[model samples]
Target: MDINAYSARLHRDLYAAGQLGGEDALVLAEKMANALDPSIRLVLLDAMVEAAGEITEGLAPGAVEVRLAGREVQFAVTPPAVAEPIQPGTAAPAVQPPAATGSEESEADGGTARLSLRLPERLKGRVEEAAGAAGLSVNAWLVRSIAQVLEAPTVQPPPAAPSTPSPTVKIVTGQHITGWVR
Candidate 1:
């Protein structure tokens, strides 16, 4: 039941079968065992060992040997079976859609998108205080504020004259005139 020892043996077997090289097999085996669930680890390991046997069988006699779980295993390689050609009028297999999972169901019901924001500490504290006072979550308060602003009508100020005096305007008879008078 020593996982490290088992992993080492598997690595050696895989390397000997030419399926993997030294060091690579060790790293691969260690990673696979660690990443997979304990319940399925042994099953995956068994499949790997089986594949190694098949791979060793294809090699020249005495080229490679596979050992698994402290026992030597034999293998024989056979020619690949020929696949039948598809007919012109044949219909291809239909693909099925993936099943909906819990996360997908929750997303559909809530219609909510998660957001991660990086805000200044002061701003974040202010938002938290406002949300608490309003009896709403920070997310809800922010969404409501944004929606209100977006839905409100925008106002624009009337245009003003240019700040600089126009060069065309000049004094005529001691009074200002927009244009030259003769």
Candidate 2:
């Protein structure tokens, strides 16, 4: 990843905030931004390294490594090796009916339901990376994501307020005029 992009976004936000202080403050902010770029870049790199370490811990045999190569940041991730690697053309295991249980079956059923999911190698890598970043196990991340997608919106949007006429600008007799249109 290009660390410069993060630094640039930080610089833009800083300069925009400086606008609130007027021209003189903006000038000083610009100068400060230039000086802060290097330091901010290092901080961003450090954060990515820390996040990678956290992800690696949850992955066990799978690992995530953050490497800085000159101006760019690179991630090297190794997914956990499957005991039985599926072939390219082979179909994954089909879903099976839930097992029969005793009187306590309803309670167990309400707790956890398992599904066998098959993901391509590249996509699997990305999913692992995302899960690691969020500091969640792959199962938890998938469950949360699926729930979010399936759940209906709980909060309805507020009704829109009546629109008010916006201000307009006009040039009258070589003088600028600004006022509401109506």
Candidate 3:
């Protein structure tokens, strides 16, 4: 089987599945052809071999070995040394801060950040309903709500006193008041 032909067919199939345009598919196919990474090629070959095995199962079963034209190379990789376990009563070493990178700075400067939070199902449903009612996306609604809460004043002035001076007045704690009467 011609590898180029197989690759081209794979590209078309992938483009169709992905719903990509003709020009995009052509570009992607060209990239794939140029790359020709061994792992990806092996994966395609493996799938084909598996399918062939299924087809030939009635004729011969048990095990199948695939032979490919390639030179074998071997290299020894030293395993990383394991750290000694901490003895009982010994304090663990402090963790050092990670070195700052360009990507981290870029992420901080208006770049999109992903936030994943686990909320109760009931709360999530309520938030989604509120968001729909407000004609805003859930993300937008949450952002606006958070901003409002942060911008609101923590304390408010006492409310204005009535014209008739009562001997004693109940001091409301939680309510937002305006003025303090002397």
Number of clashes found in candidate 2: 0
Candidate 3: lDDT over CA atoms?
Answer: 0.53
29-56 per-residue lDDT for model 2 (tens digits) = 8999999998998899889977876675
Assess every candidate by TM-score: 0.32, 0.46, 0.28
- How does candidate 3 fare on TM-score? 0.28
Per-residue lDDT tens digits for candidate 3, residues 1-182, read 44556666766666565455577766776666557646557776667655643432322212222345452222212222235789999998776543232223334665534466889999999997996665444544565576566658887769986686555556668885445455
Cα lDDT for residue 148, candidate 1: 59
Number of the candidate with higher lDDT, 1 or 3 = 3
Maximum-lDDT candidate: 2
Output the lDDT of residue 109, model 2: 51
Q: Can you write out model 1's per-residue Cα lDDT over 34-63, one digit (the tens) per residue?
A: 555453546655665556544533431211
| lDDT (CA) per prediction | 0.51, 0.71, 0.53
Model 3: residues >4 Å from true position, as ranges? 1-109, 156-182
For model 2, the stretches where C-alpha displacement exceeds 4 angstroms are 85-182
* Pairs clashing within candidate 1: none
lDDT (Cα, 0-100) at 35 in candidate 1: 59
RMSD of 1: 23.6
**lDDT score at residue 25, model 3, on the 0-100 scale:** 66
Please give the lDDT score for candidate 1: 0.51
